[model samples]
Target: MSVGLTQPIWMEMALALLILPGVWCTSWLVLYQDVCAVRGSSVVILCTYHYPETLVNKNLTVEKVMWSHGRKQFFDGPFIIDSNNRTHTATKFEYVGNKVHNCTLQIHQVEQSDSGEYAFRFETNNGGKWTGSNGAKVNISELIISMTTPKVHGPIKEGDCVNLTCMNNCSSAVMWFRNGKPLQEESSTLYLCDISFQDSGNYSCSPKHHNRPLSEVIRVSVEYSPRNTSVSVWPSSEVLEGSDVTLTCSSNANPTLNYTWFKIDGDSCLEMVSQAELQFNVTHTGNSGKYFCVVSNKHGRQNSTILSLKVKDHAEGMAAVTLTILLAVLAVVPMIVIVPMVTWHLVAHRKKTTAPKPDTEENTQTTEVHVTSPTSDCSLTEERREEEPSQQDEVPYATVHITKQRANIQQQNEEATAIYSSIWEQQAKEDLYSVVSRPTPRGKQAQDDPVIYSTVFRQ
Candidate 1:
């Protein structure tokens, strides 16, 4: 099988030639060529040559070397530089390389007139005369940038518009740059509008071809008037009397600025240097009021908003500081006090929730009952009980709880009903007295202590 190539042989050779630097070579001669030269700069054309050591048994040797250019015939042209005579057409053309296979030539401060082809020649001891074919060729070019100048030829002021143009300024657009950084604009002529101070910088444009040089750098400057006028106070407003305080006024402006302070007294204006921006001190309440500053330049002037200046005596200042501290402490006191209380409550509640439940206590009741003979002092029952509540509860204070055991009256015969009716009639006239036995304290039994109490008998 035959291997195939992805590209043609000529295409591959052309790519290889592009990858290599400028060269002009023959069988016995070699020259290092410069693709182009920039005007006003130095350029070199490197060269080297060799011959067969033995040409027909007669050794070939070089005797003289010469360089020439600008005539119709390459070899017949007058030699600009000659090694044998040490002759040179101009000081700008120099022979830097030696005769030993090194024949470098350098031109200083190249000019447009230097744009031409240069060739080299040599004569050997064996009658060998040769000139390198089509020697180093040089092309000279220059970069230029231009812009429209305002009628007032000073620096461009803020908010001014301008048009910057490159040489040739072809119909098709090209890349534009500012301060070496590329801009989004693409035009041979770049447009700048509403320029600001930040827009001041160097600008240039790209060339049409990669081999061509970029345009020279051109600087653009923008000047601006005063803006963002403001006033600042040091040591704060509301300062104590006899305390040093400073007031400063500032603004953004160009061509320098002058600061002036003013006091707005009714309709009149008082001029002072508190606007000294860049100072005023207060001592008494007389210095307190609405004040302003004026920042100005030849371009224009701007004023700051009213600044309230307050000065107080030592007593008032101390009172204010003390009040602030007191309020701050008061505000924090509630949190400090409530935190422990809330923590205690939270601990109690959590213990209540997570701890074992406590057993409930049962209530005990004691009742003492006695008969008052159903006769004696029935009417005086309430009078005695009202005067003896403590005596009734000397050993134990407990309410008497009675559960009524009622008889079914509907089931009673006529005889039993008659007897109940007679007793209820007598009981309704007065309440019956009971003799209550007060209980002793814990571990002691009661010896029937008489505690008089009242009970109502109801039918």
Candidate 2:
């Protein structure tokens, strides 16, 4: 009975020795539930362990300390931080805790792949191993900013409000940057009230903790109508006639404004053209008046000040008109006088050159013809060789002249009668032969009488 009782006691002692070391070597791990980190940044995972001091005094030494991600079970995931034989294995992971029980792991430039459940495992020199029951959770996110209220992209009108929000999983403060410069405000949301064209630029948001890997850049554009509408005329307002005049319209706007030329009529405006400039040749006074331009865009429209186009002065216009009239009169007066005078001279010259010549022979013959006796019959005759007159012959007319001469003789009856009778008898015999032969009347008797006869001839 003593030998059997001693065997039972030895068996119990052996079992108790195995259970005591296991209870002393037991460890408890404590860590944060979840850690959030940004890409391209570093993270610190703080961890602390608790174990009985009896293991340290029993010559039990820690051989290796390791950290792994992506698995809940021990030794199932790849090791990220490993300190074995007093040396670290991972280049990105570092053990930054005390050598006794703390296992703080620091990761440099943490990436998306480094985020997962991470657990700690430790080994002792006595071939004892322990893995923590709970692991630390890690989360990673990219930095992004977006316009929330507007719900639209760029090209917002001026004086409108804009709202921007920064999207990140980290608990760090959001910083707003305009054109790569930090703004005064710090928050996840940014408000821009009554924005203007100066606010248009590249905008981005980033966490204050991380300096690298900023959010994607967004562009903002402010659209507005033209401001400070101005109109300029070349060569000044006081222009001259027959000169080329140009009117230009200028303004400031976004998305490029469309220009329109207008002329201000009595109470309304007349649209002239759809161009930035209006150019034309000034001919008369009609082109001078009030004019302006309208600049417009999708946002709004603006009109320039009314510009007056004062053409040539009244005196200058009158002078030009008078000069034109004088030139016209000078050109026409000479033609009027010269043409009539030349025509009259030509008519007179033609008449003088075509007059007929007077004939000398016919004129002389008409002047010499005359009647010598009243009781005696006179006969005249003209003799010519040709029937038609020559070119050199002249027109003819007749004229007559008469002259008489008488002689007295005393009567001597007996002796003078006989002498006279013989003279008369001889004259009667000559007259009878000169006269035309004709029979005398039956009752008249022939008597011998004394008579005298006179005859004239012209050549």
Candidate 3:
């Protein structure tokens, strides 16, 4: 019975052997596959092994390794592992780790044409038959790169530091080419040169990797000239009669340049105006509006900022000024003539109202009673009982006054009349063109004399 049981185990082991062929065929197909590499780069090959002898296969050996170029052998070497577990004199195969059986093949500094299929074989035991397998077939490809665009150097002036930079897509080293020629050997982030007429050209660059091609070219044009040339008048927007006006043209160029004036119509080219001091003495309103100027030399050309002119009315402004002066004179004249005459008449009237009357017997008594203000009721009765004085008993008095000053008064009156008459004489003197009824000489005229009279009075 025990033999019967053991016999079934043997049959099952034979069935397992039949499935091993399919598994080994799949593993063999995957071992020798393709390899890929880039130019100016490194490459690595991965290889692993399997054994069916039921041992671990720890002490393995790889011999007669070769790399071929179309049946021509270029590389051949052996991989030897020392007893001390240290490496010595191994060509291309490197032992990575002990857990898995793998031989890694490495190639340094690969090129574009290093692509092809390689073939080799390996044997481990003394009586073991060699197993043949195809090595990797590699396909080489290029790396993509981009170039930076060029920029315009500013403020576009001469004798200034102008710098340029050419950058690559990758971080590798970059080289610059200008006008189809290589630049200097030193590696700098920026290329610098002082700007001048000779600095304009085409520029480009290329990267240091063998996978990339030359970059696209860029053209640079420089405009180095003056700017902000402007023209202005002294008093803007208005030009007065007989006024000295100025037109100034200012720019930023060098070497003491000259300016030329020009005038433009609606659709025509510029026509030259006066080359002198940029200013013109205009007499009428037609000489107003837009004007232009041009500045040029062997280097470049620039046009002046447009300047506009305007004129004002002269005759109307003068007439307004004259009318204002006449109004001021008329307002001030009346106050001069009336103030003194009103003052004299007020003084005479004040003197007449304050004078005292003459004295007499009855009038004196009555005056005495009224003059003493009544202190009590009895005194007030006495003041009323005092008979109102008869006109005869009242002051029948006369006042006679004489003075040489009166003669002075009469003479002043005569002088004032003479002054009024002389006013006519002054008018005649001034208006020599006045019409007259009778002809008269240019000298003095006839006049009258003074008189005295006496009078008597009774009451």
Candidate 4:
């Protein structure tokens, strides 16, 4: 225990040795992990280290680092170092380094050609050699390029300008390609400048900087047909009186196309339907025919199929013809029905009108004879009266008028005279017809006629 007071420095050094690891850990390694950048952007790679203790006390140093282009090969032969101390030169590569400990490699203005594997070798304490695993890979990219061209999807008509346009994708540059060649001004921008129908064809754009492939091609077509291309008559389908036969045009046209119309007058293809649209207001048989549309554009002209529009029903004349026919028919049908009925009625009426009324005088004379001749001697007297009768008495003086209109008059007279007769009044103008009138004697004067004769005339 007294000996312990005399401490030993050797013990302290032993304790320090036991607590620490044998070496300082410094070795070439990839410190910062991999990274990514846009096609035209920049990128960087980092390296770190842990050195052994035996090398730290000694004049140990990281001499140099190197990269190899192994794009075509999986493994590469050793290449030159990028360090200032190392002696190497190459046309394909140039490298710069950082200070001794940092040991960084910088490639200037990196391009797609710089994408490849890299490796590092170092000279250490006592000149020991150390090499790392396969080096990190660097990648470069091209700028984005997207281009478009308009392609008309409809049919082509005369006089269309065929306008076209080219567009680049968002955040991209547009370059127009025509006939497999890029224009100098067009290629400068990643976009289309101007376009037209003449620009119609396959088009594409090359990616900028990095070795990206060209975009797919697009085709543009510009074309338009005339709108509402219709042929019409000047006076419409119906021709009217006192109007000029003029044809006019009404349609939408591109490129200011001209129009012509034709007419099929008889067998000849005359230009009756000219003036764009045929106008035959004072239209006659000559103005009717087949019509055609002739449309001309800046590029060329086209003819439409023939349209036969016969000028017929005019606004004024149309109604008149129809009305006349209707009037004629209306007039004729009633006559057809009424004429026969009226004729039959008239014939029957005329027969009735001319027929004698019941011979009331003869009846009275006979009745008077019958009554007065209640004695057989009066019969001889009545016989004498009959023989003495006049020529007028031979035929009936009481005629009956049996016209339909005067039937009531005939009915009233029949009750008083025991006889019937009628007469019809004329309508107007010339007398249309006439009927007979009969007279009736009524009251005791009829009964007291001395000439009256009564005889039982049996059926």
Model 1, span 281-352: residue lDDT tens: 576789888778998887898998778879998888889999999999999999999999999999999998
TM-score for each model: 0.47, 0.45, 0.25, 0.28
Give candidate 2's root-mean-square deviation (CA, Å).
36.7
Candidate 2 matches the true fold with a TM-score of 0.45
| lDDT by residue (tens digit), candidate 2, 1-459 | 000001123453355457665442333334434678877778888777654444424655677777777665446556766675345445788878765778788878878888888777776665555566557788888877777435454568878888877888885487788888888768888888898998988888877755543788887777777899999999778777787889999998997989999998888889999999999888887888999999998878999988999789567978878999999999999999999999999999999999987543221111232222222223411222133224113212123222212111222211122211111222112211121111222443344222222232222
Instruction: Give the root-mean-square deviation of each candidate in angstroms.
Output: 18.1, 36.7, 29.8, 27.4
Off by over 4 Å in 3: 1-33, 53-100, 126-132, 143-459
- Give the clash total for candidate 3: 0
lDDT of each: 0.65, 0.65, 0.46, 0.45
Ranking by TM-score: 1, 2, 4, 3
Candidate 3 per-residue C-alpha lDDT over 322-342 given as tens digits, one digit per residue, 9 for 90 to 100: 788888888778766677778
> Where does candidate 1 clash, by residue pair?
249-277, 273-276
TM-score of 4: 0.28
Please, what are the lDDT tens digits per residue for candidate 4 over residues 190-286?
3333433444456455433433324455554433345556655454554544556555555554456777766566677655433465544544655
Top model by lDDT, which number? 2
